[model samples]
Target: MAYQVLARKYRPRRFADVAGQDHVTVTLMNALTQQRIAHGYIFSGHRGIGKTTIARILAAALNCRNPIGSELRPLAEPCEVCESCTEIRAGNAVDVIEIDAATNRGIDEIRELRDAARYRPSRDRYKIYILDEAHQITDAAFNALLKTLEEPPDHVIFMMATTQPEDIPQTVRSRCQHFSFHAVKLVDILGEIRAIAAHENVDTDEAALALLAEAGDGSMRDALSIMDQAIASAPVEDGRPRLVAQQIRELMGTVPNAVFERILQAVNDNNSAEVMTTANQLLDAGNSPAQLARQAVRYLRNSLIAKISGLTPESAEGGAAAELLQISPDEQRRAARTAALFTEEELTRFLQTMLRTFDELGYRQEQRFHFELGLLKLVHLRRLLPVEEVLSQLAGGGGGSAPRAQSAVRPVAAAPAPRPTAPAAPADTRPAFSPFADTPNRERFQGISVGHQPEPVPVAKTAPPVAAPLPVAPPVPVAPPVAVAAPVSPPPALGVPPVVAASPLATPPGAAQPVAAPVEVVSPFSAPSTPPPPVPAPAPIPVAPPAAVASPFSAPAPATPVAAPPAPAPSAPGEPASHLQDAVVDALSNAKQGSASDAIGDANFILDGDTLKIQTMLSKIMLGVVVNADAEKILRLAVRQAGGPVNITLLPADPAMKAAEKKAKAPRSGSAQAKAMEHPIVQRAQSLFQAEIRNVIDLRED
Candidate 1:
């Protein structure tokens, strides 16, 4: 007999022999012992993890003449001694049939299967049909056998094994008992391979066995296959093959995990030179860049997991680390050590970068360059400070200063001090929300030359007025005189412009003192350049003689100052009205409103003292847009920028009369589309192309 590979030689013949699938094995064994068998069974999960093996085991158990094991046992073991079991295990059973659905996936084949399932078994008690890779079966094929699969004959059973269960039609899946299998764990694969190596009389180191198990990636058959190759490549000593970790590494086309650990250490040290050198060495040694990237991604993933598991490298033998990182104990230790060198976030970023590098290497032209670049990125990534950290430093005022700063302008000359007889009045309390609380802010914006500044008015100080002499003839007594002061200039501050101050008005003796109105400070768009004209003082109130008694019910009338008419807003100096209009047009054009700018550019702009008038021949829609709130705001801002007048008015240029005159001067002509339709050559071209004219443009001027 030819020497058989370990995969087929060690294939499980009974459910109990299968590893990592006890949940499925136990349930099927119970059903078999109690004689509760379903007509259809669908086994699905990761490949090489016992999906098809379990299906075959179940098939053998169902057809076995004498099934062993009592109710207390985990499974009803198939008795190999029986003739039916022997024949089925040998793959020559007359009643049991195994079909590869990948090749025979069609409606006709399914119809034939449906016809064959109706018949009773030839020798065994039941006729079983096993379909492997059942997901490859066509939807029509599944539908063809749907009714039969739902309610198959009692003498027949259908067993299916697939890697993807979702591809199976819902109607067919609902009619079957679905059992999902899990990937064989690392420990289980390690134990199985170790036992198999010992049984095969092959000498192997612990690391070699671990490497083989890790290479399996959660598949038992894959591990066995790789072990078979490893045993073949091992050196023979004393008629027994000797397997080592280095030999296995060479055979699997992978370097030791320590290589990746060193790279990550370089990353932690922020050594780009070391990282690129390591990548160059790996590539020069004939290892694939894509393969290297793949290995790096895997290592980084394991390291990130180790960091997230919150385990120390020394104690990562058998807890969450062992459960999540499905590698050998040595590899887990390496991952844990790498994780310690960086933070959780840094490890996560490294893993993401390597994953992208691996994906890019699949189609990249210069794989080596990109792979080195990716590793270099890890080094730079280590130097980055977290956003929260940077922000905290900034908020704590420990970070570097901003890139730019503004220097204060020179201070204007100060006005002379007021006389001692005229005491200054108490300063007015501004509201909390007022923007003028800080005078420095105003001076900071003095660079803007848009509107004229208002002249500053000096604050006037008033004293208690003296009472007038009584009109009674008895020699009226006179009150003591009170002294008043003239208005004074604003406080001298740096960067502030010199304010034009006004003189105080004179008053007759014994007259009442009039209070001045509070100055109105407009928006930043407008500021004072000149002071208002002084107003006349009010007339004095009459008083009774000192000897006479005054009326207690009568209240003294309050004295209020007369308000002067508002001064006209000053226009921008040196900026002509036409130049300001052109500036406004340029501003609108810069704002990306080309049509609006063109329409406004053609309109007439006239400045009449403080008022600006705009006359336009645009339509009502265009007119509405020109006068809309947004457009009006833009116009005002443009005017301010150009240092023009703020008060603006818009007027339509007699739309009805203009429209009639334009119509009268218009030439008599056909529409462009109508003229194109009348052309014989154009009609022929349209007929030949089978095209419709959606739009027509006339190049000729009217």
Candidate 2:
């Protein structure tokens, strides 16, 4: 007999046999027991999570005969010996139909299914339709089946399985009862592996089985497949089954614990040389660059977690590291502590560098060199100061420089004072000969004095008197009396003018006044008399008037002023009013107006000023218009023709408008209006134009 592949040979036959999906199993069993079966069922989960297995089991339970007690009847755990259960398990059941939605996803296939559902089951109580990868079904097929799914026959059951639940239409989902499956846990996966190994008589350790469980990645099918490979690789001794960690690792091409440890130690010690050497060794051993990079990052992350929790690498528990590296909880904690020495930012930088280097490694034929280079760079980073210490040094300048002096001093000797009998004073005003002066210990003010010295009188000398030119007398003017004004007194009697008071000690008020004062005044006047005129008084300052105070009961101000602007002089009645004449001329000019009843001609007009009153033979309309004196008169006429309360904003023609108009009028292969009308969006807009014509006045380009 040919050897059956483990994935098929050990395929789950019943809900109880399905690994890592008890929740889903229990729910389905309860639904069947209570007879609360839904017409449509949707099973969604990752691949190998038993979506297809549970779906088949549910089908079996519904059709199983020879009821086991109520406890087991109508549940997922159907007896394999029963006809319905055994046939479904073998994929030979007549009533249970399995469809691969990926291949048969078309309207024709769905229409056939809809027609088949009208028939009764051949053997079982109900006919079951199992659609795998149901998301692959085409939209037309789904639409075709929508009516059938919403109201299927009493003897029909629809079981749809999809890994990507999001792809299914909302309408289809609303018609079904949905079940979500999760990946199997590591412990649960390991337990299943142990059970299978025991059944197969294969000898294995818990650690080896745990590794296999991890390699399975939560997929029972994958785990069993790997187990089959491991069993085949096991050495044969008397046909006994034997498996070991080394064999498992070798088969999976995983790095050994020792190699991982060596790489980790190199990084921790900041030994770039060792790190690169080890990386080269890994490559020489046939490890791919991407695989090596993934392992390195995993190791670093595990180390960080261990370091933060103060655990050795062996002690660390959880995360990818726990699942990949077979490190003990203690060792994991130790590695984590070592990783904690570096900051998250630093580690993240290292990881990013590794990522970039890995990208380069992929393209390089000689990947060992680039891989080693990346390792060396990462190790070198460990030698640099940690981010915190670097930040501290930057903040405070390392706190190791010398202090600087704040002040300087110098000594000085006193200079000799001038002779006391002479009027000249000493160069240094501070006294030098005082008893308390120049003493460092004396109080600041105790050594100081305050007083005035009398001026020295001129000494009368006994020199020979000049006897010649005997006694020439000088002319002396009469002295003027001091005049003091009193409030009620008339201006002081002018018999003698008030004396200009002379400063005291100026020849005792009788000395001749200086001649230099009059000479200085005369010198300034001798030059050109071009003195500037006095500044004029500033113009009267305008002050804002005080705000008016209204009585408490005064009426509120109108929101808008009611007074209308002055109207322009009406055109002479017989002279043909400007508006009517312009309208008549415009009517006569537009002879080729498209249609016989094209009212008002092609001319457009605007109303002028406020309270626009039109008096036309056809009808009368009032509109509000405000026109500036400089505004174009033609625009005012255009506003008047617009009629009603239309707000016709007349803008000054800008440079852009002039350019556009020029372009529009230029000769071309096609009319500019026709070209503009050609755009699909523009055509759509034109269709909508009439409906939105009333809103045009309020439309702004922006």
Q: Whose TM-score is greatest here? A: 1
Per-residue lDDT value at 344 in model 2: 65
Candidate 1 lDDT over residue span 1-702, tens digit each: 999999999999888689999999999988988999999999999989998888777877887776456442335778766788888888899898999999999999999999988888999999999999999999999999999987788899999999999999999999999999999999999999988998999999999999999999999999999999999999999999999999998998999889999999887776778888888899999999998998999999999999999867788789877889998888888998999988898898988999999999989999999999999888877776666655554466366333212212234222233322223322432222323235433433322211223343322344223244223223333343212222322232222222222321222335543432212111222222333333443533232222211222112222112232233333443322666667767777677665566556656677777777766667767688765666666776787666566677776767666655333332213435568878998889889998665545667763
- Which sections of candidate 2 miss by over 4 Å? 67-76, 300-370, 373-377, 380-702
lDDT measured at residue 535 in model 2 versus the true structure, 0 to 100: 27
- Please list all clashing residue pairs in model 1, or write none if there are none: 453-527, 453-528, 453-529, 454-527, 454-528, 454-529, 455-528, 455-529, 455-530
> How far in Å is the alpha carbon of 701 misplaced in model 2?
44
Report the error of model 2 at residue 501, Å. Answer: 50
Best by lDDT: 1
